[model samples]
Target: MKLQGKTAIITGAAKGIGAATARLFAFEGARLLLLDKDEANGAAVAASIAERGGKAVFRRCDVGCEADVRAALDTVVDVYGDLDIVVNNAGWQLNKSLLETTAEEFNAVLNTNLTSMFLFTKGAAELFIARKKGGAIVNVCSTFAVVGSPGYAAYHASKGGVASFTRAAAISLMPHNIRVNAVGPGTTDTPGLHDGARDTGDEDQGMKSFLALQPLGRFGKPEEIASVIAFLAGDEAGFVTGALWMADGGYTIV
Candidate 1:
């Protein structure tokens, strides 16, 4: 129960890595606020946690919108009375080359993938500062942030910004006793991947290509990523801050 009594608000908690993290955090004794744009799925996830004797609430929120983000965070604090952790796990991707990517597409990815992090961090940090209690923030970045992908120029750029912002936020929040860090996961098996494949109109081939690039011979599981997130958010990582922990299965090593 590393996070016993802690309150967490996780964006993108409807499915995949976000959902996995929510489950893990509940297991570790944290009260949760699960945020996602998908109301049905997000509510289902929250119900699942509640059925397992965990405390959780679901909110329909589009992290890309500052008003929505602020409202959700405010609601969590109202219900839980305090917010100690935030996981900016909401993201979007466009598998288009630089030449094919339009400004609108780039902005869309940037809004969800990067800007959301900033908005949540700013909102949460203010609360933490006012309470004079430090908090933890874990941004979900990508291995692509460190390495280039063929058709992910905008995605790469957004995640790279997340990495840099994590570091900067860590330093800026240190005085408030807040810790900010990031997790970079490699090709994880998720709904997002399926969507990416569908976008290319060759699901099998896209998946196969992704698998071939993983030296581990397989894609990572969402739970695997969640475990790392739990670690970083807990006291076990008390001394860790401004670090980008890569959970990619040697994708960047080769």
Candidate 2:
């Protein structure tokens, strides 16, 4: 019940880490707002939360769109009266070489993964400042932000941007008591990952490659990552800001 009575918004909440975070936040007593482009699954997650006795609502949003981000937060404040936490968890990945990545593809990936963070942060910070009540923003980053790989040029760039932007945003918003931080997760078992693998046309190989990178010899669970996010959002992390909390299972150590 660390987040009892708090209001939270989680983008890309239809499934995977976003879904797990929604469930966990609900259990902790936070009023939930789940956002995703997938209309069906997003609504389903909200319905599931209600069944579990948590207050939740779902909104279909393209996080990369400013209008959508604004509207989503507006709806949250309208329904819940205020906003306390926001988790920028929506993202897209591109497993392509730099030479093969088209300009449009790169732009789209950046818009989805990096620019979306900008939109959410700006939108939520405005509300937080106006309310005169500081809020928390937990960004979902990746170990790829720190590590280098052959393919996924755009994804690496976007994630790296997120890592740096999180710190800059944290410093800029400190005066308002609005905290910004990031969680860098290693490869996790999520629908998104599976989908990404399918997109690559080699699901098993993609998974094997990911597993090989983890010293733990296994993938991470959405619930495990969600726990970290919950801690950062709650009062326990009041003093922590501008930090990159890595939930990577020793992925960056080597």
TM-scores for every candidate against the unseen true structure: 0.99, 0.98
Worst 10 residues of 1 by lDDT: 144-153
**Which residue runs does candidate 1 get wrong by more than 4 Å?**
none
- lDDT of candidate 1 over 83-107, digit per residue (tens): 9999999997898999999999999
Residue 253's C-alpha lDDT in candidate 2? 92
Q: How much does each candidate deviate from the true structure in C-alpha RMSD?
A: 0.7, 0.8
User: What pairs collide in candidate 1?
Assistant: none
Residue 193, model 2: Cα distance from true site in angstroms = 1.2
Measured on C-alpha atoms, candidate 1 has an lDDT of 0.94
Q: For model 1, how big is the CA root-mean-square deviation?
A: 0.7
Per-candidate Cα lDDT values, in order, are: 0.94, 0.94
Shift of residue 120 alpha carbon in model 2, Å: 1.0
Predicted candidate 2 versus true structure: per-residue lDDT over 211-242, tens digit per residue: 88789999999999999999999889999999
